[model samples]
Target: MKAVIELNEIKRDFLVGDEVVHALRGVSFTINEGEFVTIMGASGSGKSTLLNILGCLDTPSEGVYLLDGNPVKKMSNNERAVLRNRKIGFIFQNYNLLPKTTALENVELPLMYNPDVSASERKKRAMVALESVGLKDRMMHTSNQMSGGQMQRVAIARALVNDSAVILADEATGNLDSRTSYEILALLQDLHRKGRTIIFVTHNPDFYDYCDRNIILRDGKVVEDNRNKVIKDARETLKTLPEED
Candidate 1:
């Protein structure tokens, strides 16, 4: 498997007043292509900081981060923008869909950032992505016309339309009820099966099974990074995995 992302002793710090707050401290990890990874932690555990760094929305204070073999810290603003637009896809707890736009338009938004892509090419690919997420018929519907699950599916279509190798989702199911969350998890799992690198930040432990591995963080450090039965089949966690010892 190819290494899609590689981090080496990544560090991030910020100044608040006279004090310096360390968000990520010497963290290191790698995500290969097609891996489904779940990052879990409590509030202020530095998971968000890690996600931001991974998503290229923020840079690290120190150390190296390589995404798809390119050095993130060395990339120029335009290079970073291109890398984000073409290589990384992001989903958030909130759908982040444009309130007044139809699903097709929203999914087509990212294509605007690519100067090489024509509008018709964007529309065609956006429609294909929407259909992949089971929302092809709802492409013309505005955000207000969809349910939470549908909105998230639209978000997924937007993410996939770019053919992004890495899908960085932050608290993707935080707002949904149990059934909706399960549905979203299933969709994500299917995407993973189809060979997309899915990195999901989830607070709910129940959905761990949808991912192949869990990277647990606490107090801004990784406490665990291992494959577990809990994340093997979320439903099977209770039935087959050993009780927490």
Candidate 2:
């Protein structure tokens, strides 16, 4: 299997006033292509710091970070921006969709940055992405017209439209109800089964049983990183949940 992400002794430091705050210290790991991995930690454990680096939003102060074979630490801001756009699909806690924009238009936003994609091709790919998320019927609906789950699906569609190398989800289900969270997890599970490389950063313990592997962080360090021998099927778990009133 190809290594999609490789981090070696990664360290991130922040300056607040005259003090240096070490957010991540000597963190290292490798996430392979097609692997479904969950990164868990408490509020100050540096998972968010690590996510920012992995997404190319920030650079580490020390150590190496290889993303899909490209050295992220060596890239310029512009290069990193392009690399981020082309290689990583992000799903945030907030849906992050344009308020007045239709689902199809929102999904097409990423492709708009690419010179190679024509307007017609962008629409076509966005449609395919929405269809993959079971949102073809809601493609023309605006963000305000949809439920939380639907809006999240639209976000997922937008993430998928680029055929990105890594789907980096940050507390994706944090804002949803239990049933809705399970639905989203089921969708993520489906995506994983299809061989999509996913790196989910979350604190939800419920997520652990469903993922292929778990990586736990404590005090800016990786405390645990282990593959799951037995994984719970999200779809099956969803069936066991009580119906929402």
Candidate 3:
């Protein structure tokens, strides 16, 4: 498999009033295409710092980061923004859909930044994305009109709209109930089956069972990186879960 993301001795430092905080300390790893990798850590384990760097939202103070083989540190801010828009899809803990916008419009938001896509083309692509998430019937529903699970599905659709190289989910199931979380995981698992590269960051231990590999971090360094011998099916797990009243 091709390496979609590569981090070489990445270090990030922050100045907290006269004290220097080393958020990520000499971290290195390579995430290949079509792999579902979970990044697990406790609080202050440098997971967030690493997430920021991976998302292109922040640059490392001392290391090399390559996204789709493009050197992140060498890119200008605008270039980085463009790269982020084209290469990475972000799903947050809270579904970050616009409160007043329809699901279709929200899914189409990312495409608005790309000058090559016409309005008609944008709508077409957004519809296809929503359909892929099984939300075509709810395309016109606003965020307030939908349940949390539905909204998260819209968020997932928005992330998929760009056909991103990597889908970076940060505690994606944090806001959901067990059933809903399992539903989202099932959707993610389906995506992974179809060869999408995914990087999931979470503190929740339950997530490790679904991913191809788990990378554990502690005190700004990698503690473990291991592959799962057998990945669990989220859909099958759902069947075993007691039905919600």
Candidate 4:
């Protein structure tokens, strides 16, 4: 399998007052295409810093980062933004949908940033994305009118709108209840089966069971990197959950 993300001895530093803080210290990893990876760590563990660099939201102080074979470290700010917009999709724990926007409209927002997509094409793609997430019926509903799970589904649709090279999810299931979280995980698993690369960041150990690989971080360094021998099927797990009232 080809690698979609490659990090070579990446380092990130922060200037806190008169002292220097090393957020990432010589970390390196490669994530292959279609792999579902989970980055796990405690507070102050630099997992967040790693995610920021992987998502192209921040530059590393040292080392190389290649996204889809493109050297991210060599790009300027505008170039990085363009690369990020074209290749990466983000899903937040809070389901950052615009409040007054309908589900379809919210999903269409990402396409609006692309100069290559026209209005009609954006709508067409957004509809397909929403339908894939089983949100076709809720297309016209606003955020306030939907449940938390529904909002997250809309967010997922938005992420899929660009057909990105990788989906970077930051605590994507953190805000949802257990059953709802499983549902979201099941959706992600489905996407993974369909060959979409996914990188998930979480503190919860339970979620690691569903991922193909786990990278543990501590105090700005990678403490462990392991490939999961037995990946749990989220869809099957969902079947065992008790029905909600």
lDDT of 1 by residue, 68-161 (tens): 9989998777888889999999898999999989999999999999988999999999999999999978999999999999999999999999
lDDT of 4 by residue, 45-160 (tens): 99889999999999999999999999988778999888878899999999999998899999998788899999999999999999999998999999999999999999999988
lDDT measured at residue 238 in model 4 versus the true structure, 0 to 100: 86
Clashes of each: 2, 0, 0, 0
Q: Looking at model 3, which ten-residue stretch has the lowest summed lDDT? A: 71-80
226 Cα displacement, candidate 4 (Å)? 1.0
CA displacement after TM-score superposition, residue 6 of candidate 4 (Å) = 0.3
Which candidate leads in lDDT? 3
92-198 per-residue lDDT for model 3 (tens digits): 99999998999999999999999988999999999999999999799999899999999999999999999999999999999999999999999999999999999
Off by over 4 Å in 1: 229-245
lDDT of each: 0.88, 0.94, 0.95, 0.94
Question: Which is the winner by TM-score between candidate 1 and candidate 2?
Answer: 2
lDDT of 2 at 164: 96
lDDT-best of 1 and 2: 2
Q: Which residue runs does candidate 4 get wrong by more than 4 Å? A: none
TM-score of 3: 0.99
Better-scoring candidate (TM-score), 1 or 4: 4
Candidate 2: deviation at residue 26, Å? 0.8
